[model samples]
Target: MFDTIRRYTARLRTSERAQPQGTVERRAHNLFEAAAVYVAARVEDDQDRIEEAAAWVSPEALSFGVSELACRAVVALARERDESPGAVARDLLGLPAA
Candidate 1:
C-alpha cells in the first residue's frame, strides 16, 4: 500500500512537471481525477494489502496537504487500474517504476 501511494504520488508529480508552468495546481487536480481510473484498473490486488496501504493513501489526506477529494481520486484511480495499486498510482501520478 505504501508503495502504491508512493508510485501514485511520483506519477502525479511527474505529470505535473510535464504540464506547462503555472499549471501545477491543475495538474494536481487532474492527477487526482486520474487516480480513480488507476485504482479501478487494479482489481486483483490484495485487499488486505490495500487496506494496509491506507496509511499511504489515507482518506484524511497527507502531509502535502492533498485534499480529501484528491485522496479519493487516488483510490478511484487505483481501482480503475484494476487494483494494481502501484501501477495505478503511477499511471495517475505519471511516475516511472522504481
Candidate 2:
C-alpha cells in the first residue's frame, strides 16, 4: 500500500510539474476570477465557469479593492469580447494593465 501510494504521488507531482503555468498562479488572476464568479454567479450568467474559478481564489487576494475592480473589469471585457468568462479573465490577468 505504501509503495503504491508513493508511486502515484510521484506520478501526480511529475504530471503537475509538466503542466504550463497560467494566470491562475498570479495574485491578480485570483482576484479577477473571484470577483467575476461572484458577479456571474449572482446573475446565473456562467455559473459553471465561475464555480470552477472560485475554487482558485483566496481570501487574501480578494481583500483588495483593486482586485475586486479587476474582477468586474474582466467580466465586462468577457462580455464585450464575446469570450468565455474564464478565458477572458485569464487574458486580462496575464497582461500588465496600462
Candidate 3:
C-alpha cells in the first residue's frame, strides 16, 4: 500500500514538472477571476468547481489569490451591510462576532 501511494505521488509530481513553465504563470494571471469562481463555488456548495479552480494554479499562488478575494469580499460586504470588514468576514464565515 505504501509503495502504491508513493508511486502515485511520484507520478503526480512528475506530471506537474512536465507541464510548460508558463502554464502556472498564465493561470496565476487570471487568479482574480479564478478566486471569484472559487468563492462562488464555496457559496453555492459546488465541490467540483472548487477543486477544479484549485488545480489550475500552484498552491502558493492559489492561497494568495484566495486571500486577496477574501479581503475584497470583506470590504464589499462591509460596505453593503454598513458593518465593519472584520464583522462582515466573521459573519460570512459563521464565526462569532469579534
TM-score of each predicted structure versus truth: 0.28, 0.30, 0.58
Each candidate structure's count of clashing pairs: 33, 0, 0
Model 1: lDDT to the true structure: 0.56
What lDDT is reached at residue 5 by model 1?
A: 100
**Candidate 2 stretches greater than 4 Å from native:** 1-63, 94-98
Which lDDT values do the candidates have, in the order given? 0.56, 0.68, 0.83
lDDT of 3 by residue, 1-98 (tens): 99999999999999877987667534343776677788789989999999988777777777888899889878998999999998888888899987
lDDT of 1 by residue, 1-98 (tens): 99999999999989767867665452133434333433533455656544543444435443233455456667787777666667766766789865
Quality of model 3 by C-alpha lDDT: 0.83
> Candidate 2 versus the native: TM-score?
0.30
Model 1 bad stretches (over 4 Å): 1-66
User: How much does candidate 1 score in TM-score?
Assistant: 0.28
1-98 per-residue lDDT for model 2 (tens digits): 99999999999999867767663544445566576566666568776865665666666654463466766777888889998778886665695333
Would you list the rank order by lDDT, best first?
Answer: 3, 2, 1
